[model samples]
Target chain A: MNIDAVVDFNHWRDQARLLLQQGIHPTAVNWSGQQQTQLAFDSPPATAESSRAYAAGQVPKNFIKLARAAACYRDESRWALLYSLLWRLTHGESHLLHLVTDPEVKRLRHMAQAVRRDAHKMHAFVRFKKQQINDREWYVSWFEPSHLIVPDTADFFVKRFNTMNWSILTPDACAHWDQNRLQITPGVDQPNALIQGQMSDDMDKYWLQYYRHIFNPARLKTQAMQSEMPKKYWDNLPEAALINDLANGSGQRTQTMLDQAPNDPDRLRLKSKKLRQQQDAIRSKQYPSNSAPDQWMN
Target chain B: MQLMDKLAVLADAAKYDASCASSGTTRRDSAGGQGIGSAGGTGICHSYTPDGRCVSLLKVLFTNFCIYECSYCVNRASSQVRKARFSVAEVVKLTLDFYRRNYIEGLFLSSGIIQDEDHTMEQLTLVAKELRLKHGFKGYIHLKTIPDASPELLKEAGRYADRLSINIELPTQQSLKMLAPEKSIQGITTTMSRLQAGIDEAKSQRKNRQTISNRRSQATFNFAPAGQSSQMIIGADDSTDGTILQTSDRLYSQYRMRRVYYSAFSPIPDASSALPIQAPPLVREHRLYQADWLLRFYGFSTQEIVPTVGPEAGMLDLHIDPKLAWAIRHRDWFPINVNRAPLELLLRIPGIGARTAHKITRVRRHRRLRLADLQAMRVPLPKCRPFIETLDHTPAASLLEQDNLRRHFIPPVQQELDLFQAPPTPLVTAP
Candidate 1:
């Protein structure tokens, strides 16, 4: 039997429940996410007269959670994998999920892990560009995710940035948050003109400076950097442009630091004391330590 | 100085510190506040620098103007580096801007001694105070505590910050005195003890309030909810791996430190004639970290990792990881059956980790584990082939009895020299 394409976990869950209630075997049902077929099935239609053999609560809570995440995986085999695990769990093998060596259960876990990792990468790599729209602030970001996780990871952005207005655009879907509510709409191929024009604003420049200086040339480990922040995501990252130049010049920089002569201790101490006195004079005029209020003290 | 230039200089000054973790804090978000931030149990690495270190937080010193003459520090009074200081308001703005853009987890604001210990500590706390109380920001905040700062300032720092740290700088008091003349081991430990007590008292009070009220309220006062961590310079003085691990073991057990970062002494802009001319091998730092994890999580002692009597005494084997090294030395404990071993024994295997051991125990309950089962779990077969025994496969007796087993795990000679060239023995050995 064939059903319509499943859009999300809820859509897949509803149809899977009907298939399970009808007592249809997982292999007998074809789980397709593309074109819908006509009402033609080797098995009969799901009937209300059939007793509810497996209700929602009867299924393990862990199975439901894992299945929900696994359903978001981009593979076409995910639907069949989830149903196979669900079928085995209800059918005598209630301890199937515990056997991590089982192929069907292993695939399910791998899919769920991939989905979770994709969501985490989205959280880490999404770069928001600030824009002024109609005299109000809006943060716009463009991301290319590997799975259908735009809606699943929306709550994290909302709870964190609830006071600001922001939108995360992706190839498959987009998430937007105004101060009041969150809205998920269809995907966009490109960012709007305002966001594109402000890509190289003062924020990006400051971030570049921070990235360049924070690196220690004495300990260059490009392999470690590439393992975490892979080259696939480098095009969107502004700081990644400086990585090759910095890495290529690290050897000379370290040598320069090593070959330099040690400064005279007495001369350095005198210079530091003079600089401190000048800084203190300027700071006291601006901050007046005694006159400043201690309102921050509890 | 311009803000851009100050950022470059201050960030460069702060690069020597190795702690960038922003995890293990009280989970919070800006749902109903006038801010835009959130921090959860897990920290996010927004970027990685070329040095292979994570940029989890915007790590910077408030000012690189010090009064102490530490021989190893880049911002020491006798060093000739550019100086820059950020106003409290400037730090607040940078944190908010970076956090809003999702460029960082939060601020890691440390500073050199500007006026005195108390004055510097107060300035650091003020940044956290404005972020929490004024803006209602819930992001992570880590402040480097001054050892001689007043208790009141330390208490205030705990109330506003998520994590607090004070660098031990060296392993022993004699080395600390020789290098950093102004600091002492006793003063640093006293501050750490006070901070630990505050963290403990606030935690207990929170638990009591939750029990009495029968609810988890948002109003409970938190004192450095993420706990305290510290860093030690590895190659700065004549300290052995055994001594360093012993110090860390005490810190973890006594002071309850969350982490102890081991930073290899890197080359600074201005050379210090008193210190070594060359930096320690980076793999030494990596091996120390690996051995540190064994102490905290694997239930291993400092002596077991670096024994007193051996050819390679008091130093980690740079060619192999610490775990496999331990396994190679104690070969009598090998060939353990995977299907019957407990979690502790399973963890002792060279290739199995904490998570993999737990999975093995759980999976064995349903059925007998076979050689194929380990492969399905993504265990590295070549690493564990001789150490573990399954239902279908048993390692040959001669394999465990071979004297050249260590050579099997070591990489090729050229790659070893390229990646982990051992420094001169006199420079690394403790005199």
Candidate 2:
């Protein structure tokens, strides 16, 4: 294995040829002969009659083809180096000095950026249920991720809920804690069960009721809803079973809600005004618990 | 009749107008009494497309009825199309319903001139006010300003709407008189001026960075926080590409519009004897869009693009995109060194998009670039090669021969089936 060494171009070319001979596809090696050779070497200029030249018999010597061969290898460090070199070569500079100073490593580092971003969004948005375990307390939550992020993301939950026992389970990974540091594991499908030490049915019931109450029937766009909370996550949420019934009977429920209207206009007005303020505060960029750092320097 | 029928009639009538974008402005909900949403002071809007078409709005007209006869409009009073008007309450209910369903992010309400400008503007404001004060909606709202509405009423409309827009109606003031005789350019410009004043005042106060309560008194006249946009009808009037671009330049310079929409004229029913029998080819609309893009994103100027010399000059080529056409016409600008060309020069080349330009700038920071390097950057090397010079490439000057380049741009004659192919030979001969 090449491990972490930054292989030079000549060594890469020789190493790649050996690996290819030993039954590895050129794509599988860090210094694949294809891209390494192209950036390490040079493409002959197309003839002055290049416009008339077609590709049927032309042996392809383009840098793009070479870059793709390098990308086919999964080693990110090699890919970053290759990309940096490829970029420099394309911009009219034919020197290797450009690759040495390129900051293109950020792209390699951020390959998992989307996964991390979405995982944080899930953590912020997910509402957990309370269950009593032998008269103590525990919270249960479920999530569906577009990619595997649970292994790294579970630390956030562990840090936040260190004093309370909790579990966050996803399709691919899970995190469990006993009021201490978190233990993460590859996920297997497991049904929610009452814990022996600290699970309560009353807390679960209260949370479920709150969920039902807050759901707005007025703004029920299924397509928009799906884009935010994908259908794949439906089975894991406690409110999932209630969704169909709520949607189908939305009009009736809304009518019922309207009928139970508060009579004291001033009191109702004050409460609603307060609620709107609170909602605005939560959505504001300055909320103390917001995941992202403050956008404005102030 | 049925809601579906109402939607079809209204949406189809509205489709001729291309000002459906729901961007700019981020307002939080402020209405009291247990409402689901609110339009914040700032306008955070949602457009329609996944490619970032914002939609924080319920963009529909309050009515399609009109008193004045604008020839380009489907809802002009003279047209025989069925018309419908939504009551203030009904419009509110529809908005609330759509908002709850989350099909829309907010409301963009416009209307045909009914009764008079004051009455229509008042009604439109009521929808925004009701959605704000009554329903307590906090989503983004954009309202179309009435050209002759009372300043007080227009002010109210602005207070509630996240953004405001006024259609310039057509490209040229002369075209406006010819196509829409009832409307006056002076009236439209006056309202735009007033709205601009309001926007400028609010912006100045906001820049002071005072609290909302402190700013509220200073914000006595709330214009569109998201700013304003306008639309121009293409092909309806005999405005040339040069004239249209010049007007867009003036609007951007004068009114500070956030965006300008170009709505291609669709064919009229039982078309007027004065109107052309066939609409301008769709390609004309596409070319106008390309030209507009060039003006906005590319560094091309109105005069620079239209030309001062040569035959068939001063008119955009209907066959090729404006940038490509410009590149083909001005071959002297070729062989720009991609490694060292300024961002402005790079933007002039076809197939080297803004993103690719940025990519090129970023990638070239560390190394010298070559012909093969561009292909890796995904720059359209085939199109760009003729214009750019890299370490590995230097094309012959014959690459710019007018005939050769023109052949590549304008497809084979079999492809250009014009809209009026069946018109009498004599009609084609007309100027």
Each prediction's DockQ against the real complex: 0.39, 0.03
Per residue, candidate 2 scores C-alpha lDDT tens digits across B364-395 of 87667887677755576667777788778877
Please report, as a residue range, the 10-residue window in candidate 1 chain B with the lowest summed lDDT.
B422-431
Model 1: fraction of the reference interface contacts it also forms? 0.69
| Highest DockQ against the true fold, candidate | 1
How accurate locally is residue A123 in candidate 2, as Cα lDDT from 0 to 100? 49
TM-score of chain B of 2: 0.86
Q: Can you tell me the CAPRI class of model 1? A: acceptable
lDDT agreement with native, every candidate? 0.84, 0.58
Which stretches of candidate 1 lie above 4 Å from their native place? A33-35, A40-42, A45-52, A192-200, A264-298, B215-219, B414-423, B426-431
DockQ of model 2 vs. true complex: 0.03
